[model samples]
Every structure is written in structure tokens, then in C-alpha cells.
Target: MARALPLFGLVLLASGGLMGCGERTAARAALSPPDRAEYMGIETQLLDASTVSFIVRMRGARDRSDVVAYARCAAAQYTVIRGYSFAQHVRTNVRRSGEIWEGDGGFVISPDLPAGRRNLDAEVIVDDCREQGIPTV
Candidate 1:
């Protein structure tokens, strides 16, 4: 009976460990290295002068984040090309069909860094994009 009790406790512990590690599993997944995303192309539209729209597409994304990153890279390069130092993200819509991912992002380009958590420094983001092997438009 003593040996049987220990075995039962071991079984309970093993089962509990499996069911209680959901958050740990999610954290591990979040920390996993990014997959290689293939840059397809970027289309730029002038919503106005300071406001610009970027349509970016790619493949091999792990999720919608890759598409959003592609759009961010495009927006950064576009801001720099327009002689702006910063861009504030307005909105981004991401969609995935099959293996392809598409992101439509709108930004307000400014000579100075905009006041927002979502504001992006054009030069810094462009550099990051380059380092990450992400193309910009």
C-alpha cells in the first residue's frame, strides 16, 4: 500500500505538471527566434503630404506580426525618403491568405519624433530593418 501511494502521487504530479505549463509554453514560444520571412513587395500611397499609406506583402511568416513588421519597415524607409525623422503609426491591418501575408499601415510622418508609444524613429527603424534583413521601400 505504501509503494502504491507513492506511485499514485508520482502520477498526479506528472499530470499536474503537464496541465500547468501553458503559460511557460507560451513564453517559450514568444521567445523563440523569428522565422525567415520572404519580402515580396511594398506599395506606397500618399494619403496626404504628411500622412502616408504603406501596403506590404510577404511570405513565410510565422504569424501576422511578420506582415506588420514588413509594413513598419516600409513606413520607416518612406519617412526617411520624405525627409522625415519620425513616424507615428495610425493603423495597421494584417491579413493572411494561404501562405502569403499582407499588411496595410498608415503613418503620420513628422520632422520631429511624435509623442506616442507607437511613434517610430525613421532612421532607427530603417537600421533595424536592415539588420534583420527586412527590406524597405
Candidate 2:
């Protein structure tokens, strides 16, 4: 029984070490936002009276989808701030360099909701983003 006791202890230690070997925990942690200084930012430029371009930058975010969503949320809020009821997506480009992810999106705002285009209602989008815990502006 003495020898069996030592073998059991060794097995327990080995199992504990194995539990920490997987990358799942590391991947999950990587998705979380970094410190406040490295948080996401959006810069908007008006290309015309009804069209605007947005550049979104996020640090320590590897997923392009999240970066693009931030840009969309910005466009939605900008539309509302401009007194427009809706925004139509014109185009978007996404890229990643080092630890930062960037997305550029162009939108056209209209007082009358556009049809037959990829569009979103500013009020509805803002509310949806709020419910999803996504920051907008």
C-alpha cells in the first residue's frame, strides 16, 4: 500500500498540470478588451453632404468582426446625431496590423429611409447595441 500511495500522488499532480495545457482559456482572455488606454476608437470624416467615412481602431482585439461592428455602431449613432433617420452602408475595409485592428466603413445618411439598399434605422440600431452591451458614438 505504501508504493500505491506515491503512485496516486504522482498521477494527481500530472492531471493537474494537464488541465492548464489547453489554449481555450488563453483564446478567451485574448478576446477581452485591454486597458482603458488601449480601448477602441472611431474617427469620422464627412466626404459629402450626405456621406461619411469612419475609421475604427481597436487594440488587442484579434477578431475582425468585432472591429467592424464598432464601426457600424458609430455610423448608426452619427446618423442620429445628424438628424437623419437611417444610414445606408456603402462599403467597408478591414485590416489587422500587429496588435491593432482597423476597419473603414462608408455610409450615406438620409432623412427618408432608403429602400433596396443595405440600410439601418439609427434609433433601432442604437437600442439594439445598448441591449447587446456595445458602446456607440
Candidate 1: minimum summed lDDT over ten consecutive residues — where? Answer: 2-11
Deviation from native of the Cα of residue 28 in model 1, angstroms: 13
lDDT of 1: 0.73
- Give candidate 2 misplaced runs (Cα > 4 Å): 1-38
lDDT string for model 1 (68-97, tens) is 777878998999998888888888899889
lDDT of 1 at 119: 72
Instruction: Look at candidate 1 and give me any clashing residue pairs.
Output: none
Clashes of each: 0, 0
Clashing pairs in 2: none
* Candidate 1 to truth, TM: 0.74
TM-score of every candidate: 0.74, 0.68
- Candidate number of the best TM-score: 1
